[model samples]
Target: MTNDDSKVGDIPGKRSLRPLGGVLAAMAVSLTGTRISVVALPWFVLVTTGSATQTGLVAFCEMAPYVVVKAFTGPLVDRIGPRAVSWTTDLASATAAAAVPLLHALDLLSLPLLLVLVALIGAARGPGDLAKEVIVPEAAERGRVPLERAMGLSGVIERLASTIGLAIGGSLVALLGPLTALAVNAGCFALGSVIIKLALPRSMGHTAEEASSPARKTEPGYWRQFGEGFTFLRGEPLLLTVIVMVGITNLLDAAITSVLVPVWARQSGNGATAIGLMGSVMGAAGVGGSLIAAVVAQRLRRRLVVLTGFLLAGAPRFLILSFDAPLGVVLAVFAVSGFGAGFVNPVLGAVFVERIPRPMLGRVNALGDSLSWAGIPLGGLIAGAAVTAVGLAPVLLACGIAYFLTTNLAGLRREWQEMERTGGQSVPEPSSKDDASRGNANLAT
Candidate 1:
């Protein structure tokens, strides 16, 4: 068998972890930075504006462009090469992120200015995040790791970032101030850009069309490429089902994190520290769960795991917070929830990578992710408005019920049965000639 197919323990020589390690490191810093901002930004807005609606508006501004730009950037990422796209966009995000604090310090930061800066950050970050995801299979191959395990490891990195970043961000926001956390966020973006540019092998993450069959010498236009992804995704019932379900849950999650939790903390007198502590508890437990998934997920039934995970991961946190629960009870519920949440992404990511052809990975993944995150921009906005009108308790109860219903009802769909199939592997070759020939019109290499 070829070395590429070798299992981790059975490799002929040393397995190189550099490629995977670099990617993980880059993911770690960037996600951690983002998480820190999650804590810092909302708090900053709430304290300054004293308006939950405005806080939600800021989140809407950031994520709206994130979803829109990401939906359309699939073609650019595929053609320009993910590696180049990753570093350059990260650099742009860094600059935009840095500008937030600089403008504030100069006493010139207005609401409009903040929104513009964050919108720019979101725009650059859309493709930056997509590029990082596009390279995961290549990183796994170079590391001689199983794709599922690699995805699990990626989840672990994400959770770890959430843990560390939240903890630090809370402390920074509490003691030094939000501006400090914002500065750190900018630094993390810069560091991630550097890692992607300098750490990985120069040959890595090149344009897929360049490495594909000679028929790819001719490439389709941008809109044509975008349509290909939309068409392929439209035909896949399982993927579409997954996307719809995930989109609902993502909206709920965004609401919970961006507005509900923050409002709860303030109302309960728990403040920013509690926000960090709760998130840290959950994230730390998630790290443990992701580690186990990395080891054993390949042997499990993915649909079952996913359903069970959602069962644990959803509803309870919202329900618990609906009442005047003590801090201990809240933390315990969040820990269990986080643990369940950890197993989800690895399996989902594996399912996505396995089913889609390599040549179509960029556009397909971008479309899939964008769809799954479609409701996020409105999540905080709705939550903020709901909390303002009806109060936190009723909104929490309602969201919890909605979360419960969405995940459970989704399991009834027959498309979920396809989750068990071993469809395609993340090999360099195309899954089928039809898939490979889709963009063979005028691709520039």
Candidate 2:
């Protein structure tokens, strides 16, 4: 049945929120650890090397593998099931993350060694993250929640993770050094691994193929499955357009967070505490915005919410920082930006889950996510070199202008007109290839 005919509580039997809660809890701890690294790792590289280029290189090493590995793992996630993939990868990531601090304490942590460790963490995180995204829809189904509200809750959890992670990260780096912060990150990953393994229902996170045809003998090859996802994505103009726009924005965001922000912290004499304070304030405001969106967003126009969110979320922070504004002024701009950002992912995620069929969810979602995130590795590299060649203010100014132009121009495209078509409920699997091709969707970075 189409979403219009299906209500949130339509499932006849008793619905359980346990599946959704487990997924979100796992997401929260893991994401919090990653956020802590966002603060601690860049600061660690910059202080240790005393070079912005090297700091950018460190980011490059981590994200390059993250994007590549995630792109290839979509079919594997679909075949082997997301649950097994999620736990195993989280465990691997925890091991790699823990190794960094342990090796450093022995004075054996060379720059090359550190890069290897972070790269390992990124590689493992790629599929680990994809598994979580793949499971959300099924979990939401088990919980009998609307897709929009589920995605909104996901956004809220993510924002909360960022607030807590950044605040603790900045404090730890400022007070006890980056190593202690990194150790905490490792512990968080381990805990998240345990949660996922033990908390979820056994029937959750299985492949759609398995659920639909367990007695079937034949299955498609890995490359064939990957190609199916690619072909389906290519047919959807709206999704393609969204991916392109998000790719550009993700690049700018990566540059700002990985290189520009830390450089600005050093130049403004604000130090690590300022970095933590700025991030936490923005994240705290984001939590408020996401909570509102979780409650009321289904009734709003997705297109308007997205365009407005981008208008507020993008450009302002870069411009504010470029002017060397007072700390309070900078934070005010960040809070506004963060609030706007809080509305974006929930809508986009709803669009994605509604358009793609359940069976193809893993592969299509992976390809869309990987493409949108394609430029992240280069963002820091380009920003770092540009800043070194000219200065921090000019680079920030240039990036801010670029961010404003790219987002607004993309909004003018006709495909975005379809953004409001989502019916606030889940779509069932399409019976034919052409039916699937007719569906529209959006993506986020």
Backbone clashes, candidate 1: 7
Note the residue pairs that clash in candidate 2.
Answer: none
lDDT of 2 by residue, 152-174 (tens): 89999999998888878988998
* Candidate with maximal lDDT: 1
The deviation in Å at residue 98 for candidate 2 is 2.3
Candidate 2: which stretches are off by over 4 Å? 1-13, 42-56, 105-111, 174-177, 207-216, 262-273, 388-394, 422-445
lDDT of 2: 0.82
Clashes of 2: 0
Kindly report the root-mean-square deviation of model 2 from the true structure over all alpha carbons.
Answer: 5.7
* TM-score of candidate 1 against the unseen true structure: 0.86
